[model samples]
Structure formats: structure tokens, C-alpha cells
Target chain A: MSTIPEDLSYTKEHEWVAGLDDGRTVTVGVTAYAAEQLGDVVYVQVPEVGAAVTAGDAVGEVESTKSVSDIFAPVTGEVVEVNAAVVDDPSLVNSDPYGEGWLFRVQIGEEPEDLLTSAEYTSLTTAES
Target chain B: MSRSTPLREVHEALGATLTDFAGWLMPLRYGSESVEHNAVRTAAGLFDLSHMGEIFVTGPQAGEALDYALVGWLSALDTGRARYTMIVDGNGHVLDDLIVYRLAPEEFLVVANAGNYPMVARELTERAGSYDARVEDRSESFALVAVQGPKSAEILAKLTEADLDGLKYYAGLPATVAGFEALIARTGYTGEDGFELFVRNEDAVPLWNALSEAGAGLGLLPAGLSARDTLRLEAGMPLYGNELTEEQTPFDAGLGRVVRLDKPGDFVGRAALAERAAQPDQEDGPGADALRLVGLVARGRRVPRHGYPVTRDGVVVGEVTSGAPSQSLGKPIAMAYVSRSAVEAGGLTVDIRGSHEPVDVVDLPFYRRSK
Candidate 1:
């Protein structure tokens, strides 16, 4: 039912991490599956740029017409930038979750390791009932 | 533990995203909230209302018992007729708002909200302790399905043997639908030509399938809670948590007419309502430029959200109660309580987010189709 893009890795929290490299920045956003579940995106509490975040720490929040959900950090890094375009147009998250819907870009802190690959994430999501 | 309705499997098969509503796992939406909402307005929609509670009361003095318990005098209602009434406690606070259906001279069925089922049942039982009537909760054994929209009757007419044409507004009758016995009530909350069918849960599967098959030509899609809210909002109906609450008096909720102070016998909240209505000053009184319930036709594309500030003459008059981009109306429409005295000129400006936008105040029932 939910489509997982092949180029990005995933977290158990349903967030997607794109690209790699120890020092290069990687983009992070919610999966299509998560966006479809939350009906009508209304507001997104944008995270502070240049703030450090660790894995499992909350990055920001996304408020839908019905509820508000917290976005978590998939890996430890510094948030370099946030998508202001999506903040102005919340529906973009529902439309292009991977491209224009990228929530934020984080400067990779150290060696990127133990991240679930596209195949692994696919199987991980598939194994879920 | 929470419970799932009979249409749970059916919703999952249709790829509906489920949500927990009042301890019931119900479908929040299918493809899109707006699409499902528009489908109910333009065509037809089938909703599973099985989570609501249906309680039957029958005895020699059932009418008297109901009149004592309910805010409405049930004895006055004729057979096959239904009336919306309120249930209040001794302090006049609203316990629940429900519809009482009279089936016979001494038999009445009270349909209550799902979350307030136990509370209503328990309260009724406590009061019925001194009465000759009996209360039995038939919620679990029965399932209610709502078929609402302009094309509802046409599709339903083809499936049932009962003469639906003879059934008028607020009237109900016994009928066989989809080869199962059901109480067919020609009433709905969607403000459309609709029917509420009460059938045994065991027979719900067949009935749902039959209705779906019969409704295919009518373009009836299984609607979820999202559509239900938009439809009810357009109809000027109030949700319990939003417009109606325990702290709010009935008159404040725009339901003052339902309370009958002149009627004989002392029902709960009647005296307090009378005293409050007779008070020299009422908060709900037509104060000069005081905020009242009015429809706001947005000047721009920005859809107003609840709690948004309503500004008139650079002063905050009220806040938005409900708002959305209406699919049928083709614009950003909203309802807010604006100061009646201050907003006498009609057009009021709403401070949407950070932008100041002019809004016009109009009477409710925003979208009504000429029959």
C-alpha cells in the first residue's frame, strides 16, 4: 500500500533519510505512508536551523487538520536548513514527500553506520502487520 | 480494550486509515479527507454508525417515565415519530443530546452517542428505579448504518419492499433490508435526504454488501468521519466537544427552543433554564456588537482554522469555531462567533494567521439545495 523510494533509507518511526558521506549533508523527510495517514496537513513547526539533534530526539512537529505529530531525528547531526517552502505550503508534504517535501537537511556528524537500507526498510515495513 | 465496528474489515479492504474515536477503531478517511467529504455532498455516502448506542424502554408508563427523564415530553410524540431532545442533570448542565423515537404507546427507543452510552444508560436506570418502565441497552446487538445524500432514497428504494415514499421526515418504520429485519428511520445528521438502518450485527455484513452493490449506481462511496464533520458543519449542526459541552447552557448552544418551560411537570434543568432566561442580563443576549454565530465567506484563499482571531474595526470580536475549503461552495468558508452588536454592518475582518482579511457574516445552513 505504501511506496518506499529505493534511494532512501528508513527508520522505525517512518522517517526517510536520503544520501550518505561522513561529512556531507543528508536530507530527511517523512515517508509517503506517514503523510497519507495524517489527514490534511495544516501547520509544520519548523525546527531551528543550525541546531544539533541526536537520534530519537524530536526535531519538530507537523500539525494536521485532525492532529499534531512530532518529527524525530533519525541520526545524530546538525540541522543546517529547513524547507520553508513546505512550511508556506503544507500540502507539498502530501504531494511530493521525497522532493519538495524534504523536511530538513542535516550535516552528517560522523561515520554513517547501522542505517536501514532501502531493501532492509522495505522488508522491515513489509514484515509489520 | 477498544472495539471495532462491523464495517471494520470492509474499511480495511478499501484502504481506509483508521483512527481511535471514543474507544472505537473507526476509519478517519480513505483516499483524501476532502474527496470523501465532497462525495457525501454531491452523491451518496454510507457511514457505519454502529458505535452509537440504542436503548429501548418499554412499560405501561414508559411515556411518563421518559417525560420525567428526558428534556422533551415523550408522551406527546405520536407513533413512528422522532424528536430531538436533551438530557440534563439536576444542576441544568447538559448530560447528553439525543433523539427519542416512539414506536408504540408505551415503547420508545433512545439513540445516544457512543461515548455517553454507559452514562445515559446508568442515569436512566437510576431514574427508572422508581418508574414502571424498563431500560435495556441494545447497542452491542444492533448496528446502525447511515445512507445520506440526495440520491440516498433512490438507491434505497430499489432494495427495500417498504414504501419509502410514504415515510416522511422524522418518521420510522419496520422493514426488511437486504433480507434482514431492520428498523428503517428516515432521519440523518448529514442534512440530506437520508435513512438510518438498525440491523443485527450478525446480519451487518450481508446488509453492507447489499447496500454497496445497490448503491454503486448512485455513486455511493463509504464515507468516514471526515466527510461527516464537513457535512454536519455545512448543515449548521454542532459537534459535542466543539459547540456543545457540559459547561455551556442549552441556550448558549443555540438549542433554547428545545427546552419547554411552560410544560407541566418539573423536568431537570427547566426551572434553571427559566430563571436564566428570565434573568435581567444574559450572556447570550443581543449585546451591542457582541460576537454571534455567523458564516464567514473568506475574501482570499486562506482557510480559517479554529481559535483564529476574528477582528472587526481592528478589535478582536470572536474566534473561528469551524472552517474549511468547501468543496461544494468552491471557496474558503468558515463559521465564527462574532459580536452581534459590533458586527451589525455584516462584513467583519478576520485576523487569519498574520493577515487581515475581510469576512462577511451570513446566516447558517451555508449550503442548502432546493428540493
Candidate 2:
């Protein structure tokens, strides 16, 4: 089982959104459950910083040994930062999906919609598994 | 629900990610697939290959019957030796690539891929009806476990007294491994010195456990199909569904070496293969002449996965059959069939999604084990 951080909000596509202290910026990464399901991630492609993305847009991709999955944007926002560390070592996504493996930081444009709480996300993951 | 192998519980106990492969629920990976792939190259990796088919051809004229049933001249094959051969249809279209072990003067063990074994068994039965041979599907009665790597010999030597040092590649023998009856063969898909142990279905778990305990200090990890695939890709070996298929002949896949045209005696696909061989080069023709299997080394991080288009300039010239990030080479390598002209012209690129990633033409078997 993977850890579902109580402080973070999750999307149906298995991305976690961490609201920053500034309230305008939020860090996003694949949930640990998603990372675990993907096995060993060999490569990660993230959207360019400063690019505007709409909610549900496939902003990036995570390639594992067996398959690949699109990393979708949970909310409409401008990409503020991308994690070069995860790009350099894709295994970090499997190791620390919520912390050091955070894929990108987005400056919120419109308020996030329909994000699931930790309890709800846990239920979703449990049901899927 | 997909069928489970005898070692299914063992995989679940180890937290393996299971997937349906050829209708069998097999382990795709355990933890990190990269780690397992690297282990096979550097140390050792255990594989549960019970899902593979084990068909027995035995009787007074088994070898003669096999000679007619398969492309190889099996009657001449020495007992205890295994030959890498293929079974093709009447049109020379490959059915499945196989490894046939001549166990005795009148008995052979035919190991077929999981998905195609049933068809192979049926084909063998039909083809051998005129000869004094019997084909039996013993897949359910047997289990296969392979220990592959540089350290495989030493690890296996500790358990059995069966002269691991003298067991030549592609040879098998009946032996007692950890007190269990097993037919240990020095063969594997991974390009490493290894042994594949064939045991009874009930002995699968015990054999795996004994090997695991013995291989622990030697860095043997339980590798799954995901790593197995990458390792074979690095070795430039073809998978049944990807590279070799019923739609293509051996010559089309550049695996004509396994087809024994010189072998005396009429075999299945012999006539069609001979006709194809005698024909003039079809350089301008669309069939067989257009595609030639070749290796591609990506210049970038993006991998050239199966079915990705291979192009030169702007025209699509070929398609990738198998590809992966090679742990040994530290770059993505692939086996693709490119047009002979595009191959000679030299600027080949694989369309990675929408981005055209430049790939340098290279030789197959990206990694070879040191003898």
C-alpha cells in the first residue's frame, strides 16, 4: 500500500495537488499509488515552465518499463517550475512521489474543481485496486 | 479470470505486479524492473517461466517425425542437445519459434511460447499422424524456472552436483537439483550464462525457494516478464508476437538461419521457403523485399517502443518490433525492420510519439555476455 498524505488533494487521474502557503502556487505530482502501479519509472516528461495549461490537459507523460501514462493537469494554471531532479532520476517518482518527486509547480489561474480529499482518494484507490 | 501459474501465490507473496500474458496471470515485475534487469546482467535473476509450454514428442520414430513436423533436421540432432528452431505453416509463415531438446534417441521435449503452444501441439499432432510419434501437451504437468546471469553457474553449482561448468550452452540433462528431479538446461532468453530447470508442477515453489536461498548472497533477484522483455530486447532476440508472427516468414524477420534448407527430407514450409529463397531480390517490390530487420540506437532519452514508425527524411520506412532503455548501454536500443534503401542511406529516425528522434543504425545483440 502507498501513503495518501492527508494535507494534499487528489485527482481521478492519480495526481496529488499540494496547496502552497502562498495560496497562489501549488505543487503537483503523481500519487504514490499511481507511481507504484507504474513500476519503475524510466523517464518523465513535464510541460515547460511558463506554459499555460487547462484542467484535464495532458501536460506531461511518465514512462515506465512496461507502459506509459499521461500526467494530466488537475486545474487551469501556468506552469511555474518543473522538477529537473525527477527528470534526472526518474526512480524518485517511485520512491518519493509526494515529496522530492513532485513533478511541477503551477501558479493557480482559476480555483481547482472536483478535487478529492484524502479520504475520498483513499476510497477511490482502494476500489480500483 | 486469467489462468494462474503454479507459482502464482509465490508472486503475490513477493508483492509482484501481475498481468495477463497469453491468458496466464504472470508477474510483470517486482519493485523496480530496472534493478531486476541490471541484476541479470551483473549477478543473477530468477524467473518463473511455468507459463511456457512443454510438449513431448516420443515414440519409435519421434526424431524422424520431428524432422517432418519442424524445419530442422531433428533426426540428426544428438541426444541431450537442444536446437533453436521454428515451426511454420505450409506457406512458410512462422507459427512459433521453439527450442527442441533431443532428450533421447526417440524422445524430444519441445518448448513453445505460452500463447502459441496449443496451436503448435495441434499442428504437431496433425503432421505426425503418418509417422510413429505421439505429441502430448505436458505444460500443466511441468513448471519451468530459469536462473540467469553471470553468477548463475556458481549459484546453481552449490545446489546440484551436475557439473555446471561442463554443461554447454543449449544442452540439457536429467538431474537431481536440491534433491528434486529436474531437467536442467543451459538456456535462457536473457543474454547471459544460465540454466532453465524443468520440474513437476508441485515442486515449483520448493525449487524457487531453494534457488532463492542459494542465490541470495550472489545478488539474484526475482525478475519478472517486464525485465525479461528488456533483456531480450537488448540481446536483439525476437518475441513471438512482436518480431516473429504468423503473417511473416523466417526470411522476412531476418531469422533465416534457423530455417534448415540444407536438411534432407521434406518438412513443413520447405517448399514455400525454397521458392522464396530462389526468387530474385524484390528490392522494388512491396512484399518481403521492403522490410529488413535492423537495430536502432536512439540519440535521445525517449525510447522507440513497439509499433512506432521508423522513418527516413519524411517518409515512413519501417516500424519498431521491440525496444527498451538498455541498462548496459545507458541508451535506448531497438529492433526495427527498415527498408533496405533507408538502411543503406543511413539517416533513420523513429517517430517517438510526434517527435522524430534520430536513431543511428546499429547491429543487433546490443549486449553480449563475456564467454
Candidate 3:
């Protein structure tokens, strides 16, 4: 029953990307399907601001009660901002995976390729479940 | 397709998350596992344990056969009582942990883990060839439901007219529950006061419904295997595939107290266990430095899950057996087998994925109910 917002792009790894209106940066977080599969999120590790990352690189980690998963970079860029609120209370990932649970904002260095549209992501999650 | 318990439909009706456990379709959680766990801690929680195996051993030689087959002195175990014991191979490796209930002077009921019970029944049948006992697998005929927590007795008292006060821990008696016959045992694995009802398969739904109604006023929730795992982990109980297995003996798992060497008659694994006990404490040798089960508490929220390596000074010394987020302690806790040398050195860390997280060694049983 997870809703995939039409405005956001997604990764096969279950991460969702919201491109900011400025077009220079994007906010990233895990999809609601990922959060539901994880049951409860207890800890989140976000890359420090100013760290350089390439697309598809593992930049952070999400630790749930029973399991742990890595957060991959959606675009080749430098981390511009990290969400301290999500780090303080990780349950936001389960409660609001697409909103306040955003992990970090990255300044896009190269336009990402191979990102799935919302419809495709929806189909992928449906096939998986 | 996996096997379904008699209560499977009822669980589906409640919208429980079903998962495959030991080839059986069992409920993993009703809703939120943490909510069920907390309910068991603060009040009481009901569990559908029909997946467990029940084997009946009856005849005049039932007690004698059990004593020779297992590690405990079942012949001396008083009637209407139950004892926790283990079945081991000739090499002293544990096959399964069992709870044997002496229901009558010549009858005994052996309850075993669902995954290991078929093997247990086969082993019992093979071992009892010379005795006058008859082993029958009654697993299909029975459905088990347990109400566990501090308020378990209070909830159960409303359904049955049986004397709840007289039933001691581990004692079971035939009682009428919700107008159906049940063998009510005052036993549980959640480190709380509870009752396990063994009823016919046809009575499972009615019994569960009756208990649900009686427990509504009190804080009884339907719990699943996920919550049960955490509850037992906090109680420092050893799980079969985790803390125990054929690769390790009861002594290696710090459960030597359950082995009865002075119980007169010869039992399986007695010779090997005696030889093991007589060996000198040799450092780094299989005699004494095999492994010691210890508790590990995470300094942070990253849990040390099963098969995670436990390290000391960057050297892998042990592996985590069972771990979870302890609702009562508000932290992640685990049981691991640390080598003697690493344990003595003090500083320990759990390799969570690739990152080594600092951990503190603590005593087992992170949570204990106040009697």
C-alpha cells in the first residue's frame, strides 16, 4: 500500500529521489516500500556535508531492528546538507519515508542515468511484493 | 507450499504477517512486533504455538525410557510436573532441547521445537526399542496456545474454574477451558508467568476466541513469533539453532547444570560428557577454550545480528548467535560465543557489516520479571 509520488524518481534499491525546484540539488530517502519491509528504523547514517560521491556509491546506511541496508548515491555529486532531524529520530523513515525522512541533499555534479520513473518504480515494487 | 497450523485461518482473519518458519506457515507478527513485545512485558499476550511438536510416551517403562534417552532423571520426576531437558547424540552434541511433562505415573509428554521434533521423535523411537514404552507423534492432534506475562494468571482465571493458585510452575493439569478439555501447563518461554493450553485441533478457534474475550478488559494482545524471539532473547534463553546445535554440546553453551551425571542409570552421551568434564582446563585447547556464551550490548543502535563476527583487538574470536532490539532496555542486545582468551582481554567489538562497533560485555537475562 505504499504510494509512489509522481514527481520523484526511484532506484531499484528502493531509494526515492526528489529533484529540487532549483534543479541544482536533489533530496534523497528510502521508499515507503523499503521502510515497510524493514519494519522499524532505529538508526540512520548520512554522509557528512561536503563529501564527494559518485552515482551508485554507498554513502550511508539504514539500520532497522532486525536488519540493515545501505543507502546508495543517486547522482554523482557532493553532499550539500544532511538531515539532523532524521538522524535524531529514525522512525521518521517508517512514518514519513517520502517526506521528512529525506536523508541528505546533494549538489548534482553529473546528471544521473538509469533512474526509474514513478510508474516504473511502482511496477518494480509490485513485482517484488 | 508450507504446512499450515489449525489456527492459520484465524491468524489470517486478524491480518497477521505470515512467514515460513521451519517449513510451516506461521504468524510472524499481528501488527507491530514492538507493541506485542511491550504488551507481554506490561500485561499479557496470547501466542498460537500449534507449530510446536507434541510426542506422547506411555506405558510402565515410560519414565525409565526417558531417563536413558535424555539427560534428566525422568523416573524421579513427580507426576503432574515438567522438566526442561536436552536430547544429545553420542558425542554429547545437542540435537534438541525438550520439555518433558509427567502427566501420569505411566505417561509422559515430550514437547519439542517444531523444526527438530521429527528428528526427536525418531530418535526416541529408536532409543526406546528395548523398553516397554510406546512413542506416538500426537502433533497433528493437538494445538497449543500460551498466555504469557505478569497478568497471565489473572486472565486465565476468568476462563477456567481450575485451581490456578495450586498449580506450581511447570505443573500441568487437565482442566475445562471455554467448555473444552485442555491440559493447562503453567509454563512459558517469555520469562513471565504464563499458562500453555494443549487442546484438540478442533477446539483451537473456540479456545482462542474465549481467551480473547476474557482478556479484552485486561491488556492481552495476540503475539507472534517475532515478539516471542525478542522476549526469549531478553530472558537469556538459548534457542536451538542459535545458541545450540549439533556442533556444540550443552557444556559449551553454558548449560552443564541440566546434565545429570549422578542419576544412577546410564543415559546417552553420559560417557562423552563425563570425559569432557574430566579433561583439564587447557588454554586454547578444545577441552576448555572451545567457546563461552556471553552477552553483548551495543553502545549504539546498530544491532549485532546472527552470524556477525565478534572481535577483540581486530581479531575475530566469536560469532553472535541471537540478537534483537530490547524493548525493555531500549538498546540492542545479543548472545555470542567468545573465546576464553578474548573474553579475558575485556575489550570486544561486533563487526556489523564492515564497521566494527564497540560493545560492552554484560550478564545474561537483560530483563527479569519481579515475582
- The global C-alpha lDDT for each of the candidates, from Candidate 1 onward, is 0.80, 0.91, 0.91
Ranking by TM-score: 2, 3, 1
lDDT for residue B67 in candidate 1, whole number 0-100: 79
Clashing pairs in 1: B288-B341, B289-B339, B289-B341, B289-B342, B290-B339, B290-B340, B290-B341, B291-B338, B291-B339, B292-B338
- Candidates, ranked, DockQ: 2, 3, 1
Q: Per-residue CA lDDT of candidate 1, range B1-371, in tens? A: 77999889988999888878889988888777776776677788899899999999999878877877877878889999999888888766778888889988888999998789889988888777778999998898999998998888888887899989999889999899878999999998887889999999998878988989998987898888877877887777766655666865676666777776766787767777777667444545445643356688877656676778888777888888887666667556777777766557655787865667887776777788568
Between candidates 1 and 3, the one scoring higher on DockQ is: 3
Quote the chain B TM-score of every prediction: 0.92, 0.97, 0.98
For model 2, residues A13-116, the per-residue Cα lDDT tens digits are 99999985468999999999999899888899999999999999999999887778999999899999999999999989998998899999999999888889
- Quality class of the docking in candidate 3, CAPRI style: medium
Error of 3 at B101 (Å): 0.7
lDDT, candidate 1, at B356: 78
DockQ of 3: 0.64
lDDT order, best first, reads 2, 3, 1
Q: Which stretches of candidate 2 lie over 4 Å from their true place?
A: A20-22, B280-289
Q: Candidate 2 lDDT, tens digit per residue, B139-228?
A: 989999999999999999988989877789999999999989999999999999899999999999999999999999999999999999
- Colliding pairs, model 3: none
DockQ of each: 0.21, 0.79, 0.64
Least accurate stretch of 10 residues (summed lDDT) in model 1 chain B?
A: B282-291
Candidate 3 interface RMSD to the true structure: 1.3
Q: Which is better, 2 or 3, measured by DockQ?
A: 2
